[model samples]
Target chain A: MSRSDNAFNQYLDLVRDNAAVMAKGRPALLEAVNKAGASRLAEAIEAYKPASDEIPECRLDRLFAPDYGVNIARVPMTADVAASFRCGVPQLNSLLAVVANDIFRPTDVLMRNMPEGLTVCSLRQVPAEFEADAAALLADGADKNSIAGAISDALAHDGIYVRVAPRTEIEKAVQIVNIFNSPVPMLTPRRLLVHACEGSKVKILLCDHTQTPAVQHLNLQNVYIRVDAGAEVEFYDIEESSAATHRLFSFRAVQHSDSRLTVNTDFLSGGVTRNEFDISVPGDGAYTSLSGLAIVSDEQICSDSVVLRHLGSHCTSRQIFKNALFDKGRGAFGGRIVVDEAARFTDAAQTNRNILESPSARMEASPQLEIYCDEVKCSHGATTGQLDERALFYMQARGIPRDEAKRMLTQAFMVDVIDNISFEVLRQRLHILVEKRLSGASADCSTCATACHSQAPEE
Target chain B: MEDLLKVENLRAGIDGKEILRGINLTVRPGEVHAIMGPNGSGKSTLSGVLAGDPRFTVLGGSATLAGVDLLGLSPEDRSHEGLFLSFQYPVEIPGVTMVNFMRAAINAKRKYLGLEPMSAADFLKTMRQKRAVVELDNKLASRSVNEGFSGGEKKRNEIFQMAMLEPRVAILDETDSGLDIDALRIVAGGVNKLKTDQNATIVITHYQRLLDYIKPDFVHILYKGRIVHTGGPELALELEEKGYDWIKQEVDNEQI
Candidate 1:
């Protein structure tokens, strides 16, 4: 048998082994998964095109699920572990003090850690008020035919359902912490669904972290967000996994009239990460802003594929993504803005900028605009280059060392994205984290705990 | 009095094209020296070479600041050796606050001198004092370094930095290029206030208007990469009145 066929069969057999999960799933979800599975087989037989032609081909083979046993059982959160769960990072500890938390160890929810307005349970056990919305989101995602989407629906056993009450403003951010720790290679998947009711305001922080660095794992995640009229939501996604882990994320958001949505994705350190975004503004006077930053070195890879659709008049969308790659690191950004015929007076802008710290590092960026309306204003730009030598020399001339100058310039290059964050404390924390990452300091939260303890001068 | 800045037969060029050819000059402490010449006479090139700009190759030269070999040091080391060059065109470093930039510079120099970093309160106090000398706005001091600053504000910032560093030898390259009369008076006044018996200033300008405010003890007319004439402060008035035509003819005739 050919390699592609063998790979397909291996995936099929793995799914069959988890037949109980399929049996427990919704009928529509199961049918969609089955059809998605058939399409995947055909694609394997024919070598289908990647999801986005502008970006580097997605290596589906690398995404094949490992048959190893996953740690689905809840790891008992000891008092000591709970006390040190903030990873001993000063900024993280300080930021966590004000935010509510929902901690997930692998796919198991820590019930004691659940905050108000958040429900974490098995997919089949979602609350009655949110079950229909969650099912609809999954069913719509299955129709998208993305390999990760299909796999997420077929294998994800746990779900997080959040409902922001109407006219209620959440003062503190609600943090969803996904912790991955296993001695052996395994697959972990979960679904997150958020519904912000009318006139509600909320902020969410999603942190993906790994406990160990030597074990290989795959973190498959899906997020669905819906904002009602006049509602506002801000979501920050931070990924700091180990070199042996791969993170796949599929995110979708729908906005109603006069709603605002802001999403910030920061990839500080990871082995491989592929993020897909589909955000639609179907109501007038709605605004959407998506910003991302990726700081990677070694053989790390970061890719983002985004599609922002304007289906209503007087809607606006803005996107800015920046990447700084070193060593043999690679990055890709494929962003598209589609303005429908009815979406008159739309304002859309997209920008992707990258800096390659080494000659071997590579970046590919493509910004596209598809506007069918005449009254829309759309602009897209993409640029990839090295650090500014003149700026570096200027700093050095001012008595700042070359290394420090480069760090300052790099931080400057990324500050604009971080500055747009509505939360002041979180913005400051990210600034510190980005500086640490640029200075070659280990940014891994798991490692930082030990380092901080050993290096605490006052302690 | 000992010479704070001494250069002997300094020859430099860029991209294999020679600019400063066998130039010599010296400045003693407490003296303000004005180097005047027409455009393309390598005025900026001389300052660039002295400041160790990597773009200009020092073909053959020897420059010393406080008896330390200037050419052999990196730009930052050159700075540590008490040589400061206010760039002809100041660069804008976005997102780096002026306060942070000045603190880094001060701490770097302090480190080179084996001293501890200034405390936050002390640094801000010093910044406030130096900023007052230049009449710089508090808002500008807190913003990014020269980002979105006007030409006059940039020059004021340069002098403000000079006051902070208190270098042994300061080279002001075209500090009056874009300044109005009032701004020129303020900038030159700032330079005058910062001058001391332990330091020297080199005011490089095209016109002698700036020299009217800050008197120069000695003036040298540079032509075609060489100092063809040296005289007292009156030499600046002479060049300004004659518009460099007479001096150009004299130098060109001598070359023939």
Candidate 2:
């Protein structure tokens, strides 16, 4: 075996052993633990050490510190509640749907009218179909020693696996809805694996939401995507957790030859959110685009960190992240792009723009590029400023109220990102969601637009 | 006829330095009053003070618009009360389309007047009609407000906005500063078309060239922060031929 493989096995063994000990007293979580073959993941809970310098000081240490004393309970999903969730996605016959309720339990998985040979199953059920492939894909790629990864493995209950057959094209997007209905603070970890085979095409929308604002939970999610040769994958990650919840999201993607991958992360609301992205182009002629939009206010904090690497010749990658901050909100964007020596003729660019509405709002942006190849072109830029005073006065001179003018300008700043969405209905829905979030209104569901009301004028 | 605007002994300045020192002017309905002056003669300052710009402090003044006290109103409130100021340098607002900006302004005025927002069809119809007044490109109208527009296009956009708002008293501040012949003609034509028997205009310019297009009924030559000479259209031709040196000489002689 390769040296890296050997190290990976050792890390897995350590996590499994630690998890085995931690799972001894928790009879409720044992079945999922045994099914995942992840005793080592439990072991990682205690053995993991965080790199303090790499992470910002945001009370993340206390946030990630494990609390194992809480009891695990399943929130029952009634048929009515399930039906309400269906309204989030458009009525399409070709959609593959998966619904997970609080505590990372898959309440429903339906593959209706999907292309022949496509496989969609839970992680526990993956062994019944493609045992070897599922095991290798799940156990690989992610750094098992990181605190976020270790905690996700230790508390993971359920996950979904989607495989698109070679040469097949799915016209409709796959929808995954995570509904958080916990009445108390709980730690829920979930996993997702998407494999777009050679020459296949697929689109996925993963939405995380809460049933009520009263729920306080820690949601840990790890997503892995592999795009094969000549395949195309479009992924949208929408996080609209309640103000009381903290979300830690880690995403990793690998692109093969001639493959195209586009990933957009939209952070509408959360208490303390951290998103990490690692995208690698390992084959020639591959292309990747990573974009993010975050609107945070009222002391909320959102951070996005990305690492994009081009390891093959003739590859291209681009990234743009924007944040709109209001009140005492804080935001950070850290992005790095690397082009290896062999990755000649590579083109990469990264840009981050932030706008602050209040004097107390804060933003930090770091964009870096590392190019070892001689024939590669790469650039990065960042900008942080307040709303244009001239623009504000211009609008005000046209009879728009000061408050309304501010709102209009803020909405205009997000048009570049919102216009990138190809779907018409989804784009309009996102417009409403962004407007509500900017006005400091909390939305109940990320996917449902009707639940939010327009902010009333201050009397 | 009742005066559309009345300024009595207006004394205003910026940073405690007097600019408009005890100036007075009046405009009755259907009158086009041109305030021509040399540079630093407080021509633009007069327009700014009248528009209720917060940068300037009114030490002593009583300016009334349509029998209402204009000094107590905000800039937007003044706009709602049938007052408009065509900025000398229109500010560029990125990401705000001209359509949205115009709509917001129209609706704000409408709301203040206790009227419903204009229907989308009517709004678009009005936009098309007014856009033709200045010959503004359809593409430019849909783009961000004044963003990346040329000097002439920005001036044209300002006039187009005036046509849409249809204010009772319009103040054009240096409207002919950077315009070619064709653009100047189009802007002047739009202003003339919007003129009505119940409305008036204040044209503040340094040159008499703009007077050739929009014929002014009264020409007031302001020198040293006050109106030194008021005359007919013949005075503009005389000033253009003899130059502002003659006016400054005349004002200096009067001061002595």
Candidate 3:
């Protein structure tokens, strides 16, 4: 057999060898994992090709190899540990009240930072009131087709589940911190389930970070959200890992009637980052807005795949994704919107814009719309180009240096995404972080601890 | 008194095609010189070459502002050395607020001059004082630079920026191209208010409408990349009355 075949077999063998340890006493989940793994083992090598036409350049096997030995280490989450982490980043102290926080490791989940009005615990130990609903949601959305999906599904037996009370509004946002620090090659699997009951409102922030740049690893995450009738939910996910780490983040959310849902993803730094979003509006009068920004450089790659479905009448969805690439960086965006025959008066629009700062930098964008109804409004557009040289010269002629002019233009390109955010403090904090990233500041967790301290905004 | 701006045998072009050929000009402090010519006569090229636009290369020439070598410095450095160009078409920069853009420009110049940066209060006060010269609205000052601005508003903004920087040599390149009579009057009035014995101005135009508002000490007629005549402000009116056919005929015959 060839080298890649051998690696694939070795990966399968590792998954089989650690079945019991990774399963965490969930028999049904293990059965599902084994079934999915067996089906994949039976398919031809061509099965490893990219799953979508928009991702022709993708090599799925190389991008995702759980060959990192499956090693599970547990660390308790205490007040001191949480406080130290919070104190390291000064902006976080003033920006986030952190109503609920949880940290996930390679194969373990630790939940210690818990404020009032939030129920944070392992999926296996959910309270009796929310236990049945959480399990049903997970079983319905579980990945049952691909190798990585099967592996993550099995590891998700030890995932975190949160529930926001019905008819209530959360005063502060909930923070979910996922930290991956491993000495050996490992695959960290994280699963999060959030259920907002009827007439409830909540905002969530998820951050992915690596402790060091020494270890090579992959973070596979699955997020499932249910927004009930008349509810409003906002989810923001930010990824700032080291260059040695790869990330496959997925989010699937369903909305009921008269609900509003918004999801924003910011990919600042990573080795190879792919974010998948699937939002479904099944009830009439529901609205969804999805926005994302990615900055890639130095052989890094970041792609976002989004699918929005309108199934009920008068539902609306809007999506905008922007990417800035420099120094051989690569980026791709695939956005698709579907409106059913019964979903009359549906309004949907998708826009993807990119800037390539270097000759070697590349980007691909594909926006598609499928409408089976007569009275629906749908539009999509994609553009890829370099920065406006005229604008740069204009700024320089006004006494601004060329480098500063470029930075200002780049930052300006990303302001619309940040402007859509409803939180004032969060918007201000993101502006600073984006400026720092554009200036080539250190984005690793360790450097962030010290860099953010000195760069904090003065009162 | 020393010449504020001296251009000697300056030749430049874009993409290897020479535009400004054997051009010579001099402007003493407190003097306003107007360069008038028909279309494609290199009126704007001189302003671009002096402002150090990379597109138009300096084939063989020398330009000095305030006794400083202008050709050797970058565009920002030239601006810091007291040179400004009011573009015919002002660029629209989205997402960059006027406040931030002006602050960055002012601070960069200050750093080049070895002076401390301006305080927020001081900068705002300065902005307010200069904004009135052109009747710029308070809302426009907080928005992005020239984004979604009308033609008249953009012209007014250019003069406001000129007033803020207070350049020693200001080159207005067709600033009155898209302006109405009222806007032309306001912009020219602002330039006149900012004039001083320590600075000079160059007004490049195709018509004498702007010259009517801002009187010039001397008028130069540029033809075929060369200045064919130099006279007083009446020269603009004469060219307006006789048209460029007479001058073009005379220059073409001389070249033959």
Candidate 4:
């Protein structure tokens, strides 16, 4: 793109003609977009087209609005945050270059990657209030480089960055919803700069809901992750895009020697969603775990996961994925464990399991290991099969109706990843979701064979 | 009057090996009938078939419970009809808590009898009262079904379920197998408490040890798949004292 290209189009028009700026004048909105070169935000949002018809109303726009008090300037910062001033070769955003995404991405590379030429309409009711706090974020952002260009490099050469300010000591959670009504397929790249202080923890939940009709194209996303020392960070994504949707998310992360990072994704509703997590531990005693689960049903909701250990001794990484198929849904998982020569004494495990609930349902898992380091403990395995008929029989013989029996056993099969959630409320809520999906999709559930065979109406 | 359970010319086995060959026995309500046999005898097979355990194929004859065609029903159907099998080896169910399993079983029986579901309060209250009958630890009632339970504890839990079900026919298949005297008494006591004139019990034990506590008015020696001798409760003493050798000799002599 030429230096004088549409680069500065949205902002130049607004700023060059400053009078009407106040008319569109939502302070918080200005603050969120101001820290970043407004030109960069405008171009990214301009090209990102969301693919899906049937868009549902979302509350994210209101959530990020100035009335939501998205003050970037006044938010406090710490030594680590102050260190983020050098977040890049040149620190571009302060709590106050004000910007943008994955650790939510370091500055705003995700916005820059909206599928080329596809216009992703920003969710409406835009937030008008934002206190520029790039410096405040610099005060709390990672002392190390938080303006990660790795992801931007993948999709955009010059790339883009938006400096974001921390609202508080985000402990236990960070929930966000990205709604798309673009009606066209797009590729999105997100870079994350998460710097959790010692003994701190956080959970980030991203809900990607599409309200567009099925476009026969695939959407792509590249996400980068970073966690500081002694900090525990959790990343979760929920995809409710309906049948006829296909998307792939590229997850990459670098964790410090002692920090813990976990990335989990769930497919409650999706047409065809494929996710890959490639994580590395550079810190000694640092750990990275990649785990996910999906209910594979008709159309396509396939998940693929990959875990890698780059460096750091005593580092443990685990990857587990489960898929339960019903009503002709197809699923496949291919996993690899790559251990670098220097990353010795690392304990790693990878397991992929798939269950077929109907004769028409199908699934397969392929687990691989490419370990270059010897004397290092690393392994990978995979298992695939239909539900245990004997287990079903035993459960049925105990008076549990057949469908409820399948639900229980299928739930038990997926219980490993779920029980590890470490939160009671969320875990139980997940079970409820699982129950609803399995029961809603499988009419044969809870009923015996005679009923199921007779009930099949040749649909 | 018809006895509670009657098995005539019962011939059953697994994979073509005959275990119970033409064994005839009868059990009446209010009576504890103990079947004492050697290791390979058909003691467990009878209980298996009675409980509708699908493992064995009944090769011959018939088994009737309370004048109903007992062998024709499914295991769960038989159970709902008040037939209980305190398994020699109880199945371990993980993730399914005891309270939840019990609730399901209780509701299944209630629904079969055309009764409404039990309120949570009544279920819990009944659980509390029955907890004392089987002498179960209050904590265990909330744990997963029979998971990580001691051998004795598993048996007690079986009787505890037996108590909750209040079956008209309970086949205690080696209920006293792993228990110390105390647990044995507790299990037997639970069975005794759930006893009624409308119910009958078939206590299958390898030794006479369990028979002493849960007295049986009728004792039968099941050997080589047939009841060689039947008499009063004293038969159990005779077998325990003389062992199966004399009985085998008597059979051989009679056959010759």
Candidate 5:
């Protein structure tokens, strides 16, 4: 055998022989408990999750109802399982689906953005591949928890980003579908990093989900977006996990000056989806918008938001969070608009409005504003109540069904936030999807439209 | 006479407080009728009860449209049956765009009528023509339904919707409340343009302004919930000049 074969065999021998050594105590680092270079890394792995006392089981009917679709790819994507990644200095950035090379670069992301000495690794292969790469990284003297965290971050970015060419313009919106199928109540961590260059605009739909009839899935994802000057970024992350899971999904961005970041998070599912949006303007005149729409039902879910806006001078930040709940569903909002003591001329506004469709449904919103600057316009407000019964009656009297009227009102409630998505096609497709989801899934398949179905490009 | 709409001794209230004691009226095609009343005389309440605004409870009586039980139908259903209520206060649905709402409404009505759904091109064309009647701006039409609309614009939009629907009987409920002279004229103009000899309009107003523009052939003075007086266009003029005291005194004396 060649020298490379000898090295491969040696690695495999190491993995097979140290199997008992790799299997450690619950929630402990498998191979990094003995590493030397990184002391804080093993302690970080201690933060990993063990199963909670009891498992929370739910019915499949309440999960993927008959009307709701059963997309094959979406199942795993929405679960948003926290896979592993290896942390090393990235060397290559390409736009390929899968690469089997001896390179240290992430070859999937179209435009890779990394600081010096940042290595990107993820669980991108089969079981054997995972074991081999994990063992190799362990041999490289890297700590387990830090590597796990770094891998989570890199996987998050790779998972959410579209891997088209740098110059390839995606006119239609692309959805970042994540799924978690783990039976164990594991603490799945994710970090998404993006750097969109000039004029390359894309709208992302991040759909997170977990399996039905399972214990609670705790998912944690952090997103970092860097839009180069003049590159437009429109992001919409929909957290529709099964009500059996609890998700802590934070989508944060570091926006360069003059780059626009439009973000809309939809919390239509999950047992508890706590979303934190930390957006800061590192450049003068940067624009950031954090808008959201959430629909809750049954004894299901609640979403809390803590938004931090460090808008620089001449920067603008707009926050809108809308919620619609029925039955025992509840939604809570705590948003703060912060302007630095020296962030002069900052314009920021926050609004949290909720519509409760049932007497049992409840919502609480607290919108706050903190401005130390003199020449700034900052405001915050929140309102929570039931859908206007009069409106329902009017529509019903016009021959619309009561349920249909409720759906329409809810749809109308989310319109303001939905309209902010600048991409027309993506906006329409999403609108269609939301209407279907709200109205018990109608028969509108935007993908089946001529524009998408045609062999050639036809809009 | 073929009655297009019939209300028989309709008594209603909100939260058990009786507002509309008993309202009886009949409207047929090719005619315009106006209901004029003083403040809090249940003018808006009548429209609300007719349109099934859930805020009010129907104490008694019923309303029928084109020989169909109008009270049993939903608002969208009533609209499908050509019963349009140009609301006094239209709702502002933040994310639902004007075009989307209209399309949903139009498709719903069409589904009931057993007609094929209109294509996008046709819908846009029809929207354009009807919006012209109200002289609505394209930017406003493209925005969310009634979102950030001024009082006049919302009222005019009601008329524009009335035009788009081409209902059998359009109920203009206090649509003139917040409008200036020009907006009232434009709204009334849109109503008049949409009114064919086949359909009628029920203009609910407190002032003679919208009456002056729409020119209701018959005017009813509702006093303490009932139509105490019904006459020609001159009744609105008389009420405008003399106020509501004469009709109130007449009801009081007749009762006592």
Candidate 6:
């Protein structure tokens, strides 16, 4: 066998050994994977390798281990759990819905009032006529070498596949919520695939929540999107995990000629969270914008890595990421923009701004740009500073208490990113949430999932 | 009249360099005291010390407002105790609207006085009434505090705030330095209208032009960290005409 084949077989052996060890007292989970034909994909997992160096040390490496001591047999996949999970879905008006209760386990998928020629269904429930096409799309959509992608292919049980018909438009936003309810340490790998046909338009909101703040789990999620010519898509990812949870999220998108894509990632809470976004504009007149806001405090660590590439002429891209670090919390931002030789007339800009509230709070930012084209406009900037003392004194002189003044200034610093959300209701909700988080009010409720559960109807 | 403010041998400095060497001043309710001096004469230092600014170290001083010790209170507490300073250069606070800022200030003072917070309707009414006293634009009142405001607007905003707070003692630090004829008239008029027999005002200026609008009961020439001369409002006009050279010559002649 060639060296590449040898490496692939070695990776397959590792996955097999891990599955055997994790299957201890969990025959149902193993059986379910086999029934879903994921066992066949495990052999192909060898072809993918983990990009370990791409992420920093989170100090919770055990969460990434394959056999992190979770017994899927003990996790009851009952109808009651599914019902409870569905009750927690945000009361938003949408036509497509996907609710996942635990790691790699989707509890429900529904398509309501969808436009003509649209297909939406769970990976395990795809119709026989579309099975082959769905499988091929999954296999070809994402980069298998990335850590999230490799783990997802080897362990993910089910996911959602959405295909919009050409010339179709969906006015409301499709909502996908992932609910984690495990009492023990567990590992969950999930995936989502979307293909916007030529001239189609869609909006998506993907949210993650935990049932309890005490559960320790590892969540690896990957999203793959394809924007066809003249298509437009807006995707939002909001993560509100518990303190004991470690989350790794990767989003990748490809834009065709005249297509537009905008992705907003809001990292509210987590233990050791890392998010990555990679987009490529390979067709002329394509546009891409990525914006993110991360609020982490206490001992939490949050990082964001973004890479945008302009491979065709007349492409435009802009990115802005802001972070607020308090207490001993740490944050990192790595942004890169590349203009290829053929990408003439490209206009790209990136900015990373951070505010450190406490002396112990830390932030690291790196912004870079690579330009191979002469006729391009590209700029990048990064800033990390404390609150303005003059502004603080100004407020205090107005008879506002010192603490309230600090909170007001901090909120003002973050409003630039929060106010950009297109939806009014969601924007208002996020403003309240961000204000509470900045004031250390949400420290006790590490799991927003439980907060949502309390509002959910009891079955 | 009751004594509303008393400063005795007040000594303050920044970075261990004494600025206000030994100054004595007292003001009764309904009195307007103007301290005129050349540059680097510690006119601003006295205002800084009274406002409880931490940047200045009080070497030796005793200031009181209505028999209450002002030196021991924090800046906010001093403000709550009916002390207001119209800053020479107002700091720009972005993203904090005027309505919210005024409400917070009003509630803080109310809380200090052991009263319930003002209702929104009442607060807005008070804001409208006070804003008109300074002839401030409604649009400026809704925007962020002093953000993108012109020099004159900033000064007018300060006077408007002074009107809103209704302090027992108000200090105008260089309030007329950057104003034109119309702006100076409007600002001085606002200060004059807000004056009451139960309150006091201190006008700190180098020129006597502002005194032309709001007459001062006392004019003191501050030189070398001490008040070398104290006279009626005519002292300001005399200093403006003869300059500080005459005052320096008189002080030197006295020492000889």
The candidate maximizing DockQ is: 3
Deviating ranges (above 4 Å) for candidate 5: A1-236, A250-264, A277-289, A307-317, A336-349, A364-378, A388-402, A422-428, A442-459, B91-93, B132-140, B147-154, B175-198, B207-217, B232-244
Best by lDDT: 3
lDDT of 2 by residue, A328-430 (tens): 8889888999899999999998989999889999898888888898998888999999888767766666678778888888888988888777755567778
Clashes in model 1: which pairs? none
Q: Candidate 4 chain A — worst ten consecutive residues by lDDT sum?
A: A447-456
Model 6 ranges with Cα > 4 A deviation: A1-56, A59-82, A85-98, A103-118, A128-133, A443-459, B252-256
Off by over 4 Å in 2: A1-59, A65-80, A88-98, A102-109, A439-442, A446-459, B9-18, B54-62, B250-256
List ranges where model 4 is wrong by over 4 Å.
Answer: A1-168, A178-200, A208-221, A239-241, A297-301, A326-330, A353-363, A379-398, A441-459, B16-18, B252-256
Task: Please say which candidate is ahead in lDDT: 4 or 6.
Answer: 6
Question: Which portions of model 1 miss their true places by more than 4 Å?
Answer: A1-8, A20-47, A51-58, A65-124, A446-459
- Interface RMSD, all models, one decimal each? 1.0, 1.4, 0.6, 2.8, 2.6, 1.2
Label model 2 with its docking quality class: medium
True contacts recovered per prediction: 0.61, 0.67, 0.81, 0.17, 0.57, 0.59
Evaluation by TM-score, superior candidate among 3 and 5: 3
Q: What is the TM-score of each candidate against the true structure?
A: 0.90, 0.88, 0.91, 0.71, 0.69, 0.89
lDDT of each: 0.78, 0.78, 0.80, 0.61, 0.64, 0.78
The top-ranked prediction according to TM-score is: 3
Each candidate structure's count of clashing pairs: 0, 7, 1, 73, 35, 0
- Against the true structure, candidate 1 reaches a TM-score of 0.90
Model 4, position A28, has a per-residue lDDT of: 38
Instruction: Give candidate 3 misplaced runs (Cα > 4 Å).
Output: A1-11, A20-47, A51-58, A73-83, A87-117, A445-459
Predicted candidate 5 versus true structure: per-residue lDDT over A97-160, tens digit per residue: 2111101124334224422222234323213423443333333322123333332321121122
lDDT of 6 by residue, B38-154 (tens): 899999999989988778999997999998999998788888888899999998888778888888899988998999999999999999999999899999978988999999999
* lDDT tens digits by residue: candidate 6, A25-135: 433422354323344445344344444543344522333543443332334433444444443335455553534444333333343366576777666566676666566
Task: Report the C-alpha displacement of residue A194, candidate 1, in angstroms.
Answer: 1.5
